[model samples]
Structure formats: structure tokens, C-alpha cells
Target: MIDFLPMTREDMVERGWDQLDFLFISGDAYVDHPSFGPAIICRLLEKYGHKVGIIAQPDWRSTSDFKQLGKPRLGVLVSAGNLDSMLNKYTAAKKYRSTDNYSPGGQAGLRPERATLVYCNRIREVWKDVPLIIGGIEASLRRFAHYDYWSDSVRRSILIDSRADLLIYGMGEKQIKDLSTQLSTGMCIRNIRDIPGTCYRTESLEHLWDYIEIPSYQNVAKNKQEFANAFKIQYLEQDPIRGKTIVQNHGEQYVVQNPPAMPLTTGEMDEIYDLPYQRTYHPVYEAAGGVPAIQEVKFSIVSHRGCYGSCSFCALYAHQGRIIQSRSKESILREAGQLVKLPDFKGYIHDVGGPTANFRQPACEQQANRGTCRGKQCLFPSACKNLNTNHSEYLELLRAVRQIPGIKKVFVRSGLRYDYLLAAGDREFLRELCEHHVSGQLKVAPEHVSQKVTQLMGKAGKETYLKFKKAYEQTNRDLGKEQYLVPYFMSSHPGAGLKEAVELAEFLRDTGYHPEQVQDFIPTPGSLSTCMYYTGINPLTNEKVYVAKTPHDKQLQRALLQYRNPKNYDLVYEALIKTGRRDLIGYEQHCLIRPPQTKQLSSRQPRPEKTDKPGKQRRLTPTRNKTAKKQAR
Candidate 1:
């Protein structure tokens, strides 16, 4: 019978286990789904015949909660859930988010900031000598001494702060398996530091070879140029095949990172997804309305992992790597069959995609043998001549999934790399996507339209997006469908200024597309864009970049995206004037917003005469009342 791993002392008793081999502490609620990273790791460990138990969202205030699972026989694993704790708890504005979907009932404040550090410290207090290991998105991205957006400073590697015995980075199935074997064989954690995809602290680097050392923490923290230089080295050497060990010094101790683990083979990927997963949050959370985060992935299938689309603002390069690892169609179909048997089956399979939905194989044949090219991207600026842009395999997989029994419709909700899709020149896939898959609307990310901004973001420019838009519209017309394209746009990236913001607003105006939501770039750890944000220079190209650092400056850039919204009128108007583009504020058909003079005149003439009847006053229209409310504010 498939059941959740032991979560409490009672659960341990029920399993007839006196001790767990590893105790997994997570900041997220106990979710047994494969989509959750903690679940995957824990379930994989259990599959290896090691007993594992979880302590999810433990009270970090004291050692009381940390001691609930007693102490593990071998080690304790810690993770800050699926997301970095700081990013999950706070918004780009550095304010507390009202809700955390990973928590029960969507409550906030269940986990502390820098949750990995806090949880590790608590574990130390409870079991001073227990081996401690940290992994997950929070630990993986912040493994090196890098910039922290929340603190607005360069902080030391999480290994140093959390005092973790070891740090595992990336999708760490391989690393965990190797580490567990060594530990089970009676090897000390400190001496077993040569495993790939793991980072460890050392007093000296005497034993390490074929490694390159970047600038020390002291130098990078004080000098921006040194910081950029260090990041450039780290970014280039992230591949598994060609990458070398990277070491950085922090005072007397040094942090050494082993080369990344090889990407999972198709058979390995199938084994991982085929693990017996309960596929939902633990029953303990049912009373609290369960975890809100699971709803998005409960029915959706993850067909693959990794992406070749190296967008600068994304950290996938560091975490998932550039190599594309996919599951076999047979594996995916089996998962779909399981979903169809669920009691909540609604006939609709929410999604059947991954990081970039249509990417089902490596970018090119050589990537499998030689890894990705360093300091180069497969899809950016332009698709490389060697890039394989075929969609036949992915198209066939989607077709096979749709033919699954009891499956009515399978939507592709994940963002598709439109540039890659177009490069494939597969009109059949496009036609089939429009004819069968899309759920009335398909969302794509063209991040920005300005040529300079798009280049900085490592995304396609306006011309490419426009071409795709035309093709999509024509395809829909051919299918006699009224499908729409919802394009996602970002604001206030490292190189974007008021000028680029206004250019984007103009594009939106011309297309008659008013986006309901605008994404403001957040410079999270481990991304090249974050390096640019902290140091006013692109690490890869040492060129000076414009950064909108102040709150008001960022506000103006975001406002320009939704210029039609009356609430953003003031900031949009200010941005237009600041950029010397006041011409866009007129009453012309091409104008984005009306002149302040016109707006003022209209608001002032909105009051009507009082009614003669007692207690009867004329009600104002929503537009007039909204204007009045803005004026009062």
C-alpha cells in the first residue's frame, strides 16, 4: 500500500520503527506529492531502503519541536521547502506577503525568514553532534557568498551561516544517493566531500585538484568589480562535463563546490516519477484545508526537467542546469492513467509540461556527450545554428497523452519558448496546439519588447514576438477558434529604465493589449540578473548597466506597463515626462494616457445637482466615483 512517510512519533510507532535513518525537516507543510522537492527526496531515500521521517513546519522558537522525531540514526536533512524562504515569505517590495500557499489554509508567518538557518540551529541545540545537511532551492542558490536582495548586501555562503555539515545543490537525487551510501558505510561526512554536486567547508584546499578559486568573500563584499568577476567565473563553470571544482575563501575556512552531477538519464527520470507517492498533502493537513500549493500540481504532469532557454533573470542555469532531462512517453502516460483514477477527476488534465513546455529533448545532439557550451546560450539573441529545433517528439507525446482513456482535455499552462517553437518551423505542432490543446487562451512570456531590454533579459525582441502573434492569430482563424494570446511582460529589470518602460507601454497600446498583471523583476540569489542589480555591471560582459534601485523609480517603471489603469496615472505621467516622451500623453489615438489637464477638467465637472427628494442623493457612476476617490487620496 502507498502511504505517506512517517511524520510524527505516532507515525513511527505505527510503522514499528524505533529510529529513523534520516529526519527530514521542511519549512513547507507535509506534502507527499512528487512536485514537492522535499517529497521527492524523502520518497527517493525511502525507496533506497532507508527509513526516513519528516518534520514539516516545525516550531522554530525552541528545540521542543525539533525533538519531536527524536534523533536520526545517521543524519538530519533540512530544506526551506520548494522556494527560498526569504523569497517565499516576502515580496519584491520587501514586505511580508499576506499568504503562503505552501502553508496550511494559506496562512502566513508559519516559517521564519532564513528558515534553513533557523531550523539548522534548532537541530543543533537538540542534537549537538547529529550530522546536518542542507539542500533545496534556498540552500542550492545561496550556496556561494553572493548578494542577498533582502539584506541588500553580500552575505557568506549558507554553509558558513547555517553551520551545515554539507550543502547539496541542484536537483540533488544523485548527490543524496551518493552521500547516503557513504554515510551508511561508516564514512565521516567531512571526509566524504568529493561527491559531485555537493559543497563542503574545509580549512585548507591541499587535497583538491583541477579546481579554480574565485575572489574571496572579503574582496567580493567590498569591491563591486571583484564581485562581478567572481560571478562570471561561477556562471561559466556550472556544467557537469566540463566544469571544474570552484573554491572561495571565507576568512580561515574555505568553501569548496564539487562539479555538478550529471543530468539524469531517461530511465533514471522514469524511476524517479514512478516512485510510490501519496500524491497529496499529508492527511494531518486535511483539517486545515490542506496546502494551497498542491492544487496547481495535483492534476498537472511534469513531463520533463531543465530548460535550455537561459533567461538572465532565471536561476534555472544554476539549479536545474542547461541540459534537458525528460521522461519517456510511457512513463508520462502511466502517470496520466493514475490521475484519471482519482476521485476528483474532472476530465481535464490541467497541464502536461515542464520548465519550457515544448522542450522534450536536449538542444542539440552534442550536449549529451560534451555538456552545454560555456558562456553561451542555446536560445537567446538568436538560435544557434547547431541548435536542434524539432518538436515532433513533444508533439507526439502530447497527442498520446490526449488519447488517454477518460482524459477529455490536456492544457499546456506552462510558458512555451515562442522563439524555439517558431525556429522548429513545425506548423503541424502549432496547428494541433491551437486545434486541441489550448484552453481558450495560451500564455507566453516575451518578457519585454524593447530591443535593448530584451537583449539584457536574454529574451526575444519585439519583432519575434510580433511574428509569433501574427502566426497564432492566423492559426486560430484557420481553426475557426476565438483563442487569445496572453503575453507576460516584466518591468524594472537591470538594464531597463524609464525609456524602455515607455517603449513597452507604446507596444501594449498599439496591440490593444492591457495586461491585468505586471511582473516586477526580483533579484533573487544565484541569478546573473541579481549580480547585475547589485553591481551596476553585467558580469558576463563587464558593461555598465542602468539599474532602477529606488522604490519610486521601480514604481514608475511598473506603472508604465499598465498605463490605462487610472490608479497609475500619476506615476505613468511622471515617467513619460522624465523620459522626455511627453508626446505620448496627448489625446491622439496612439496616446497611452490623457493629459493631466484633460483628466483634471473631466473630474472637476463630475458632480451633479442635489435631488429634491429627502434622503435621496444622485449616485455617481463607477468611473466618476473612482476619480473622486483618487482625488480625495
Candidate 2:
């Protein structure tokens, strides 16, 4: 009864169940860890007294593997693993990736491309009529019509294409419990369409009330302007309290997305994380090199959920929402105590943070009751007047965890919003962070230095990051700690042209920090930045913005970030010339590059008068010549 949920028919029979209530199909191998969505959901369902089975990474070429676990009594739950299948199989450049960390042995090509659609289709072929519910990152992000980066075209909701009966978006613990509870009572999936945090297709809108209708999918698909217009409406309605249900016409039927579910209270979050997860991949995978994804998160603890950072390119706001929900300090400490008891527990606790590490409370007290303001962010344009900027609770939580015996250090590896930290006005937190949490280096995301580009990215001004940097350095100096700050940067973001790219390079040079890892803006589905990338206009304002789409241009922008690398010299030189910044290519100390050495110039005599002029040479004579020769030698 304590083992992993039935993966084989024999295991199901051993559990004395003739049929399961839900059969969970996932693109990832079975890892009964809380970090994996499928595991958390399945464990929660089992905790609620429903029987469940898992069919992980089933063969998609045929239905034979899909039918191995037999049909569920109520429904079939489908997911494309923990990550979007498209992102898992392809890089940002749209090239096929060779390995999948979610699979055993870190194998490649275990699941087909677009795993959610393929898995749902396979389930349909097997059952012919079972309720197919798709939930996961892939289904969550694509629950509405959005641009598909791989195909460079607009795609309709995954609910429409996959033919699934229901799509649960966001962190679907609450929604899934409601779904399973209703299914247990014999209510059909179609009739359970009123659940918040869920989406379904309907032919009639008679029962739906208080819903706003977005532009039809056909219209958005045809008109870029209409797509941007529709997206703005969707973005505004993500709040749980004030958000209205959204309906979009797709031909004869409609895709109806209910309002977001309320975030879990502290007690509810504690219960979910405190579940009896095995905390590792299934033992069956030990011979296959175990799950590689768990290695990073196995020792870490997720103390909070959701983020208020609201970076335009990030899908967290759209997927996890802007609400900040956290686990109780007791719950977090209890988990830490358990972590220290594990055989693999090192003195170091790898990380202790969530989407944005320092955000331990709601953006404002009213957010939990009134919901986040539509079309306005808590920390964008400028920090909202109502924003709550404090890190006292978070700082105390970190201190409490580290005080537990057997734990040496706890780092905050997840993103630390520098702007928010600056807004908090707590020098104590900065001092503690530099003194303890930093492991020789701390990573902060400034994204870019240009104001125009940062605005488009939904980040604060460069001055905020600069302020944090000064404070952090001062804290380290006060403590006599020899730690450094590693800032993360991006390239090829919307509204970032050659000019902005060069500006970022100059900023990096001034800071004397060259980032080893750089991210080219990937226009993933279900993000405001993706809307801008596809439409070439700011979706929120309809203002035209520059975008770097071509591979050459994107590479040049990326190269500019690491212009010191010899391998990037060609791309950096090309970017400088193209941006009319040829002055940055000289031998000056501030230059991004030294002028390229030419075959004709490498062997030329050292005469002061010889310039690029084709056939002219002037020489100095007498005492001037002797001084010149001595200088040259």
C-alpha cells in the first residue's frame, strides 16, 4: 500500500482493485516526488480515497501500450510530463534536443512530439469514450489560442485540438480535487464545466453567465491586431476574486475558461506539500541512471508558490498567477527536519525559495480579498502605491531553517527579484543574504540595462539593480565576505534591437561581469512577450516594437553579451558595425573588441604616418626617428 501507485496491471490486481477510478497518463517517467506535477496530483487523489494508476511515457505509435493498464472507472488524466513536450523535444532555436531528463537514463525520444495531443489521441483510440482530462505545463500554457513558436503560427486551444473533455490550467491541485470528487459521484465531465481553474468546450452558452467573450479564434488567427486585442482581455482576467469567466468562439463550438481558483491558504499549502511522497523516482529506474531532473530539486524545498514578479517573458504570471502563496513556517521546518534525516542529505541544503525567492507575502493585503488589479501590475511601470515591500518574514524563515541541526548552508538558487528587494527598504535582509545564503556567488536577474527594453520586459529600471548591487557589495564588505554577484541577462527580447544589445554589452563591461550563460528570448506559449514577438507590436499598447527574429540577428545580439569570448568575436564585430557603433571595435580599454588583425597589417612596418590609405607611407627622421625607433623597439 506504501509503494508507488499501480504502474502495471499486476500491481493493480495486487491492490485488490478491479479497475481504477483514474488512470494518469504522463509523458514523464513515474517519479513519486512532489516536484513532479503528476505525482503531486496523483498522490492528492489517492489521499482523497480515489484509486489511481499511472501509465508513464507510453508508446504513441499504437494503442497497445495505452490499453495495458486497462480503462479507468471514471476518467483518463493526461499530461505532457512536467515540462511542455515541445520545449522538452526542441530547443529555443527549434532544433530537436537529444536527451530528456524526465525519462529514465535521461533518454531521448521516449515520447513523441506534442505528447499531450498524442497521448490523448491514443487514449481515445483505446477507450473510444472515456473522459480524457489534460493538465500539465503543456496543457496549461496552451489552454487558450496563442502563437506556436515552432511553427511560427497561431494555434487554437489544446482542449480543441486534443479533443480532451477538460483542461486544468495553473497549479491544479484544488481544481483536480474538485474534478475527482465530482467524477466519483457519477457527474459526467461535460456537466462539471462550471469549476474554476478549468476549461471546457461547449456548443451552447445558455448555462454560462457573467462571462466576457473574447474575439473568436478564427478572427484572432487571421488578424494579428485582433490576437493582441484578445490577449489583453485574457491577461486581465487571471485573478480569482474579480476575474470573470472567458468565452472564445471557435467555429460552431466555444472554448469556455472559468475564472482562476483561489490560491491555497497556508494550511492547504502545508497539506499538499506534507503528502506522503516517496521523494524520488520509482525504484525501478535505479538501473536506468535514475531521474536526472530530481538531482537539482531533491535536496531543495519549495517554501512558496506563485510569483508577483510578472516578467513579461515569464509564463509564471499567466500559469501560476501573480498571487504569492506560501507554506507555513512550521510546515517548512518540518520538511527541513525530514530532509536532514535522509542518507543523501549533505550539510548543504541546495535552495530554499520558489518562483521569486524573497516574495513571502501577497503584493498587498487587499489582493487576497479583492484580487489583483486587472491590466496593472504590482511592481511594473513603478511599484504600485499599495504594494507591500517587506522581507522580515522571509528572512526569519531562512534563519529558522538554517538553525536546525545538521544543516550547514541554505542557498536561494531560484530567482531573487533585485527590484523588489530594493523596494523593501530592509538593509538587514540584504546584509543577512550576503553573510549567509550566498555561496561565493548569488544570481540575480536584471534582464537588460536599457530602460526601453526593461519596460517591455515588465522589469523595473536599471537603477534598482544598481542600488541592490551597491548594497550587496557594502554588506559583503561589512562582513568581510569575499562573495560576488552574478547577474542574469537576456538577448533578442522584444523591442531589443542592435542598439539595445550594444547598450547591454556596455553595461556588462562597466560592471566587469560577463555572464557565462545567456538566454535568447524564447517566445513560449501563453506569455505577453510571446504576443509581442509574434505581432511585432506591444500587445498591451499596440505600439510597434523591434524584434530580432532571424537567427543571424539573434546570434549577434547574444554574442554581444559575451563579447569577450574569442568564439563570439565575429558576431560581436558584425553587430557593432551593423548598429553604427564601429567606435566600439578599437583598442581602447572600453572597447568591446580589439580591431581585427588583417594579413596586410600584421606584417606592415611601424611608421606613424601609414594609415589605411592604400599606397602612401610617411617617415620621421633625425632625433625624432631615433626616439620613434626606440619606442617601436
**Could you tell me the TM-score of candidate 2?**
0.94
lDDT of 1 by residue, 415-521 (tens): 79889999998899999999988998888999999898888889998999999999999999999988888888899999999999998989877776776578889
Candidate 2 residues lying further than 4 Å off, grouped into runs, are 598-633
Best by TM-score: 1
True-structure lDDT of candidate 2: 0.87
Kindly give the stretch of ten consecutive residues in candidate 1 with the minimal lDDT sum.
606-615
Alpha carbon deviation, residue 313, candidate 2 (Å):
0.3
Candidate 2 residues 190-242, lDDT tens each?
89987899999999999978899998889999999999999988998888899
Question: Number of backbone collisions per candidate, in order?
Answer: 0, 0
Candidate 2 clash pair list? none
Identify the runs in model 1 with alpha carbons over 4 angstroms from their true place.
600-633
